[model samples]
Target: MHFAIVGAGFTGAVLANELAKAGHNVTVYEIRPHVAGNCYSERDEKTGILLHKYGPHIFHTDNEEVWNYVNQFTDFMPYVNRVKTTSQGNVYSLPINLLTINQYFGKTLSPKEANDFIKSLADGEIDEPQTFEEQAMKFVGKDLYEAFFKGYTLKQWGRSPKELPASILKRLPVRFNYDDNYFNHKYQGMPKNGYTPIVERLLDHANITLHLNTPFSSENKVSVDHVFYTGPIDAWFNYNAGRLGYRTLDFVREDHEGDYQGCAVMNYADEKVPYTRISEHKHFSPWEEQERTVIFKEYSRKCEEGDIPYYPIRLVNEKTMLNAYIGKAKKEKNVSFMGRLGTYRYLDMDVTIAEALDASRKTLDCVNKNKPIPVFFVNPL
Candidate 1:
């Protein structure tokens, strides 16, 4: 079977690799000069630091299958994302742990004392949270919410917390203990050689052909057994409905003589700070040592026509548009939409890989049964 995959990112690359291994001819078209999509990482020629081209992507997931699968392509270095934040002229650890609670209040409270204190601060009136503001207030109360979340949320999403969904803040933890680890995952690490090499290795096969800096469209559609599209779902149909809302990021790069922030990520809780956080690239790979350091101050805004979409803003309007696109996609022939962009969701690397593997297995099953390939292996909505 012959397959044409659009966008040589994790989804496309994984699918291409899986299908190629099963004796299928795969052709990958990537508009960008490089692969790996938002997970793209490369070394800076001047500083000699391996910079995460987009931003810091800490590979953390409890899924054992994804953990083992990724290990096959590249060796992952042990890395844990410990984030720091600045609020009201004070530096604090993130996730609002015991240490942060103590530092913020200037009191040495035990875990039980801290928990009870937070409960006292919490808005006992509100039984259920309907918005991000309500959720935060109920969880950690006004002072902590305003200090840490309010300004940052406004800057990151370009919207008020009251207007956003409660689910956004639900993922954030308010720890009683002194654990500052950002994620609670069984497997957490970064690819030693970087993510680009992983995708390159995936596409590096006898049955797979790579096309760099190529824009794939309906015109580029060829006589193939199936098409696996990892590009924007709206763009695939030429935005017949409307563009889905997404937040794009602009990175301000800086080079310093020595250690900059002394951490991988530092979130600015104040709205006065233009950028959300300043990430020191060298700190991401603590195993490697370098004299100079590189950092990127990340600024978030509504995704423009040509800007690379970083995070999907799944607001009501965006979801409506997405559903329309999904409806159109379901009726399409010999095509399978997979990945974050295609599904119109913000997916971690592990979830993306797991879905791609599932899609590939399903595709092979369909071929064996002489059935038409599905429009989506997993529901987009």
Candidate 2:
């Protein structure tokens, strides 16, 4: 069978690889010149630093199967993202650990002491927390929320934390212990040769043909047995309902003589700081030594028509718009939606690969049984 895969990112690349391996012809159409979507990484010509073009992407997942699958493509170096955030001219460890708590308050606090202190500071009156601000106040109290989350959340999302959902703040941890690792996943690493090579290798197959700088529109649609769209769902339908909300990033590239931030990611939690975070690219690849370091000061804003969408702003209004698109997608024949943009969700790289693998397996199974392909392998909403 022949498959028309849209957007040569992880979703399309992974599915293309899977189907190609099964002796099916796959044609991948990538609107961007690059194959890896947001995870595109390349070495700097002058600095020799492996730069994450879009932003910093740390591959971390508890799913052993997904880890092993990515390992097949490229060698992954052991990397733990120990994030640091600056608030009110002070730097502190991320994930709100005991060390952070003690440092912020200027007191040596034990795990138990810190836990009790935070609970006491929490708003006990608000039994049921509703918004992001409420959830943060309930978990880490007013002080921590205002200092760390309030400004950062507002800058990142371009809205007040009170307007955001509680689920957003829930993803951020408030730890009593001193563990400062950003993610709790068992498998955490960055690709040795960078993310682009891994994705390029995934699409490199006898049965697969890739077309870069090719936009897959209704006018230029290909004749294939099935279509796997990794692009935005609303865009596929020509934005009939409305443009879903998304937060796009503008990276201000900088070169330094020595170490810049001394960490992979240094987040600016102060609203006074224009950019949200500054990521040192060389720190991402610690195994390779580069005297010249490169960094990106990331600024987030509302995604426009031609802007590259980074994070999905899945607020109430966006959800309504997404649901309408999903309804239209379900009615389409021989087409399936998967990945962050297609499903209209904020998904990690691991989750995207896992879903792509699952979608491919299900697709192949249905083909063998002469059953119709599913509209969506996973629920969008």
Candidate 3:
């Protein structure tokens, strides 16, 4: 069977590779000139540092299957994302560890003592936290919330914490121990060469044909047995239902000698600060040495037409529109919507790859059984 996969990101690339391996003709269309989408990385001309063109993407996951899958393509270097944040004119470890708590409060407390202290600071009145602010206040208390989360959340989402859902804050951890590793995943590392090579290898199959700088719109008719779309769901229908809200990012690149922030990622948790985080690209690839460094000061804002959407602002209004698009997507024949943009959710790299793998398996099963292909392998809603 002939299959069409949209966007040459991990989603499309994985699907194309799987289908091609099954002896099916697979054609991938990537609007961008690059293959890895947001995960695209290249060496800087001057600094010779591998720059994450979109932003720093640290691959961390507890999924052993995903770890083994990615390993087949490129060698991964031993790298743990130890993030730092600058808040209230001070540098502190991220995930609100014991060191951060002690430093912020000017007290050297034990793990048990710190846990009790934080609990005391938490607002007991709020029985069930609904909003992001309430969740933070209930978990880490008002002081830490204001100092660490409030300003950064506002800058990242361009909205007050009160307006956002509590689920957003649920992802953030507040630890009593001094473990500052950003993720609790078993496997955490960056590709030795960069993500682009992994994707290139994924697409390098006999039956797979990759088309760069080719945009696939719903209007464009293709002669394929099935279509796997990884683009925005609303875009597939030309925003007939309404455009789903999204937050886009703008990176301001700067070159410097030696280390810039002395860290891979240094987030600014002050509202006064314009950019949310400054990522030193050279630090991302620590296996290689470089005298010069390149940094990107990332700015977040409302996504507009032609802007590369990063985070899906899945507020109440956007959810309604998303459901409308999902309904329309289900009604279409011979098309499957997958990936972060198609599903309209903020997904981690591991989750995206896992989902793509699952989708490919399901697609093959449906074909072998002579069953109709599903509009969605994973429920978007």
Candidate 3 lDDT, tens digit per residue, 1-381?
A: 999999999999988999999999998999999899999998777777888999989999999999999999999999999999999899999989999999999999999999999999999998889999999998888899999999999999999999999988775598999999998999999999999999999999989998899998655445888899999999999899989999999999888888889999999999999999999988888889999888899999999999999999888999899889988998998999999998998899999999999989999999999999899888787
**Model 3 residue 211 lDDT score:** 89
Candidate 2, residues 1-381, lDDT tens digits: the string is 999999988999999999999999999999998899999998788977888899999999999999999999999999999999999999999989999999999999899999899989988888777899998888778899999999999999999999998988665588889899999999999999899999999999999999999998664455787888999999999898989999999999888889988999999999999999999989999998888888899999999989999889898999998889988998998888889999998899999999999999999999999999999889888
Candidate 2 ranges beyond 4 A from true positions: 219-222
**CA lDDT, candidate 1, residue 189:** 96
The lowest-lDDT stretch of 10 consecutive residues in candidate 2 is 217-226
| Clashing residue pairs found in predicted model 2 | none
Error of 1 at 238 (Å): 1.0
Clashing pairs in 1: none
- Give the per-residue lDDT digits (tens) of candidate 1, residues 72-188: 989999998999999999999998899999999999999999999999999999888989999999889999999999999999999999999898876558898999999989999
Which residues of candidate 1, in runs, are more than 4 Å off? none
